[model samples]
Target: MLDAVLLILREVLEAALILSLLLALSQKLHLQFRWSLIAVTIGTIGSWLLAHYAYEIADAMDGTGQELLNAALYSVVILSVIALGLFICPLAFKSHLENNLTQKKIFASPSGKKLIYRLCIVIVSFSLAREASEIWIYLSAFTHDTEMLSSALIGSAIGAGIGMSLGASTYYAFTFMQKSYFIPVFLAIITLLAGGLSMQIAKQLMQIGWLDSATPLWDSTFLVDEHSWVGELLYALIGYDSRPAPIQGIFYLLTITPVVSACAWHAWQLRVKTHE
Candidate 1:
């Protein structure tokens, strides 16, 4: 039960943290939660359906189907975060959509609203599906074992309760900070999270022989092993891999470089507008 609770808590908090950040964003954008609600519903159904076909999924892609699917989900999350962060940044706005190519053209135009709405849907649904599927897979594994049926059910319930409680606490904490006017800081954290998730995708790709990674650059396991509880929490939250492969580092930098450049470009455009 303890193991179950910890496992569920870790995964739930990961997905919940993303949701909390998005919820804070809805307030900033004056958007309704209707789409988010829909996302959750769809995500719940989708995860259950996927869980139903767990065997095929696990065996697909040369036994790396799950990794591939997770990579795709993480990609969606990373892209959505980047899109959402553009809106979160106060200076991101379009100026006639003709003045400059480097200007913030995403959330500042007519189609921007629709884009944001689509992004919100993906953000919520994909996040929920990614985390929920893992829990379902774990819990489902024991269903066929008659002796472990009772234990599995009880553990799942207890785990879910603890996970939800912790998730709620995390949401409230982020909300408090957002209300206190720390939105930029929050966006920065999200940028890192997105980059980290992208790195995880790179790792998954390598796992399936799609990406070639040379070797480990260095090992920090002695300092912070990735198997430890704190390591797992950090992994879920920020993609903190202690013994990161060289490709992971390269990919993480590659992902963040453009995002940072875009932020800089937007800042420059904002300055140019102010001067004019």
Candidate 2:
């Protein structure tokens, strides 16, 4: 239940952040409100469709095929999280490119009437791919459990609602009170989540034997059951495993520490640039 909630929350939060950035950019650029709304609507629909399809595909697989599918899905999730850590985390601190692109599309359109449609499709496709990919991974993780599936979906809806509300509030606060003040904090949180997700993916993949070199660096199985509250909380937030294999531990540290350090450096650079 907790894992389901965390997965949904993280994915929904990321989507909300992306959409909010796009919407805020549109307002900043003085773009048409209708066009922005259309874009967001299309993006949301596309993401939903893609997520449905991914769930269907997972549902169809069984036996060894299901295991293989799960393994592949997790591997993709890990890589995607790593990519976000390396690229998107830094980009979030910078100006909004989606808004810039929308502005360009609007200006370049021969007929202003068609600009909204074109912009909507483009933005929808872009955001949908990222959002759906994350959703697919989360769904794949719990494909075998009907109760967990329902719980995750409910959690995702709730998380999305919370995220949308927060996003709206953030936009208002930034626009009215302190311009760009929240970007650093937002970037930091995203970086940490991405790092943690990547670590979790690595650990999961190692468990499935998709990766080589397995030996526990330290076994804390005696300390706590993984399903216990303390264990589960650490697992959800920090990707902590009490009995992690040596290679898993190494991969976790290797993937998380550098990404975090890099994000910190990026945040510092953004701060300096803002001041200058």
Candidate 3:
């Protein structure tokens, strides 16, 4: 039961965090949650399909198919996250500068709103599909063992409840922040989240022998136990690993640099426009 809880919690927490972030962004943009509903439905079906075909998928690409597929999904997720940050920062900053919750002039266009809506949907759908597929696969493995199956199911429920509750708390915390701080906070979290995902891609590539592995860059487990609740939260928020490989750090930096640079440039442009 404990093993099941931890496994399910990790997967559920990841999806929950991503969904909560994107949903919070949607609210900030004055968008409806209709896209969220569609995304959830698509994600549920996708997870079932992926889990149903797991063996075939694992068999493909000379037994490296699963890693390759996961890498592809992670890449898509990272790119989508970067795109969201790049697109939303300016609008959010504009709203902040105007000192309004709704940027009427900026939010006037249906196209802009639709684009953001679609991005959020894509992020949530792909993220949920990837993360929840693991849970589905785990639960399916114990189907023949009724005794263990019941325990796994109960553990999964508890894990999912805890994960969702944490995610909701995060969303509400964001809602309570002042507008001036929200833009930076949102962008920082988005950037770090994308970097963490890129680390996942690096791990997948390494597992498939596509990328060279290296020694651990550093170990912070002495300061914070990786299995603790705080560690789990950090992992969900930023892909925190106590002893990440050097390649993971490299991937993290590579992903973060461009996002930071782009956001800085966007902020600069916004400042210049405000002055003009």
Off by over 4 Å in 3: 92-106, 270-276
Error of 2 at 22 (Å): 6.6
TM-scores, all candidates, are 0.83, 0.44, 0.91
Candidates in order have lDDT scores of 0.74, 0.55, 0.83
| Top candidate when judged by TM-score against the true structure | 3
Instruction: State the local distance difference test value for candidate 2.
Output: 0.55
Error of 2 at 55 (Å): 8.7
- How big is the positional error of residue 228 in model 1, measured in Å on the Cα after superposition? 1.8
| Per-residue alpha-carbon lDDT of candidate 3 for residues 62-87, written as tens digits (9 for 90 to 100) | 99989999888888888888887877
Ranking by lDDT: 3, 1, 2
Which residue pairs in candidate 2 collide?
Answer: 215-246
**Alpha-carbon shift of residue 103 in model 3 (angstroms):** 4.5
Clashes of 1: 0
Q: Answer with 1 or 3, whichever has the higher TM-score.
A: 3
Residue 264's lDDT within candidate 2 is 76
